[model samples]
Target: MSAPGEKVTIARKQKKLTQTELGDNVGTSRDIIGKYERDETKPSIEVAAKIADVLDCSLDYLIKDINPEDELAKKIEQLSPINKEYVMAVIEAFEAKEKLQGKR
Candidate 1:
């Protein structure tokens, strides 16, 4: 499994954010962000949380050894109430269809 720092680096890059930009958002310096990316240093829990916020990812995703589906669930958790309901409904529909087709 990748380390928390590595997860942060990957998520930041996937979001198209530079180290400097991420640092600016997280109230840190580019050098510090670079260090984190290089796995030479670890951020404080608060700073890590801020980084996750800036990267639009869950803290679990950055720090825990979870699968991609867990990450997707985390993303869905951030949706608005109505959107959350809609997404859940869609997922349930798909699951029901799959069950009917003996695909599960």
Candidate 2:
């Protein structure tokens, strides 16, 4: 297993879900979510599985040393064609912005 907290935080944010929102979906509280993100506490496997589902990621992504890009590609592959196009446009815009700032 890798740094679970970091993976949870990244996957949660990638889904554009607030900790509170994620907690609500997972039948937990925002404080618990915060604790998980800060690594102050660990969620049970069941809770972790729920978190993964709500975040649209897999337990493997959260608990193993998996490449994040692969997880994201998997999610993107499941999107509708129009939604995929939107994602590509967003990626292009972000890349363009990064280029303008000499970040890439």
Q: Which residue pairs in model 1 clash with each other?
A: none
The residue-by-residue lDDT of candidate 2 on 1-104, one tens digit each, is 45889888988888988999999999999999999999999999999999989998888878888776887899999999999999999999999999999999
TM-score of 2: 0.63
Window of ten residues with lowest summed lDDT in model 2: 59-68
- Report the lDDT tens digits of candidate 1 across residue range 1-104: 88878898899999999999999999999999999988899899999999989999898888888888876888999999999999989999999999999999
Give lDDT for model 2. 0.91
lDDT of 2 at 99: 100
Overall lDDT per candidate, in order of appearance: 0.92, 0.91
**Winner by TM-score:** 1
Clash counts for all predictions = 0, 0
Candidate 1, number of clashes = 0
